[model samples]
Target: MEAEDFAGAAERKAPHGDRGGEAPRTLPREQLIGRLTQLAGVGNIEEAMRCLSEYVGASRFMLARYDLLQEQGLNFIVTSNWPFDLVRKISGVLADRYSRSTELEKCIALLQPSFEDLPPECRVPPGMSQRYCSLLFCVGRVRFALLLLFPDHMILSQERLREAALLAAYGASFVEGRSQRNDRDFELTEREVECLFWIAEGKTSDEIAVILGISRNTINNYITSVMRKTATKTRSEAIAYAVRNNLV
Candidate 1:
């Protein structure tokens, strides 16, 4: 689905409250599960995201591809209902953080929800929180992060947040699965993709050899094969190509 379809879909007025505006009414666990189940059958990523946002009392949602965060432009963004300006400002920060994180840290972070304060210069909407929530999940080999905005000082349910993340992952699998099936031009092997992932994480051939429990020369061979298949002359270029195309 196109990003424009849901870019501003979550900008509706909030419920009236003493503190300017109230948090969106959160869905109970059972109801949330029911809503997500129905959304799964509908196969609409935007709606599923909106449902999860509201179910967790969030005001806005931006679903982005974690792997492509380091790439230039907004191609990393899968779908978002966050403001265009805010997205542009925050994406660079997220990319920088992703680049600094180890590969193991990223894997352990999957399906976990974390919070971060917005950049000081960002102009948050009235009654919205300065801190935002982010949850990561994987669909096959690809990883995605769901960034959320909620009302100021609003306490969100941990259980619901985790549940929402899983449902979001489930919803995304359908969309991404279909896309992968139709686009098979890369045809990189699993081992080759593994090498690309490590190299992207800044691992040298010798380091990757130890990590994968293979010979250094074997690791070099895998790198060579990846470069050849991806038509990249250097290791950096191959990793760049892999990041851009979400091959790793």
Candidate 2:
């Protein structure tokens, strides 16, 4: 979904519980589960992005998957704001520097949240602005982030942040398992299942290949086979399916 679409959607869903601009009531655990369950069922990526966008009360959100290789930068599974050109440019810039910060390091190493000040390498083009942006958590092998745009300094309560993180984690898992069966677990080879688990943890294909002692192409092939068996279109969908089915 385009960033512009967020404003309208927020207007429709907003004023629900806002106290002088803060969320009036934090989503209860049951509500959160319901929302995430709904998200798991979304067939369209935009619908999922929009679901996440409103849930977090953010003007924009992005789920970008990064590989450790110096050359192949980040991949955008879903983006709410930040223009395409900017995302490409900033992703390249952020790739090398992410490893330096403790938050980024923890996020990459242990699937933790990197919710800190924006990395210096993230360059906003002329006329662009943001207030708070954070790497919330990683799901499987993907890093999911929450970016709050300018004029909206969302001082997320620790409880709310924690809850959002948990919900985002669920979303990550759901996206990670998107193409798996809804009723039963998809039958995947040992390597494919291993790859699926790590992908949910945000590992790159090369990482999986190395861990499995196989070529990257072979790793990709396994993923492809899994996706075919599950009948998913994108890797995100496959992961979502896996999450829904509790495959990994």
**Ten consecutive residues with minimal summed lDDT in candidate 2?**
1-10
Q: How would you encode candidate 1's per-residue C-alpha lDDT over 1-248 as one tens digit per residue?
A: 22222122233343211134455556666776677667755667788889888877788999998888887799988888898999999999999999889888998888777878889999888888888888999987788999998776555555566777898998887776555321333577888989998887678999999999999999999989988877889998997787656565
Assess the local accuracy of residue 231 in candidate 1 as a C-alpha lDDT between 0 and 100.
80
lDDT of 2 by residue, 1-248 (tens): 22223222234434332325656444556876776678665634445545555555555566554433133434343545665655665565555555454644655533322343344666554433443445456665445554443334233333344455666667667656665554335367677777777776567899888878889998899889888878888887777776546565
TM-score of every candidate relative to the true structure = 0.79, 0.51
Off by more than 4 A, model 2 = 1-29, 68-74, 99-104, 107-129, 141-143, 146-152, 180-248
> Model 2 residue 180 lDDT?
51
lDDT of 1: 0.78
How does candidate 2 fare on TM-score? 0.51
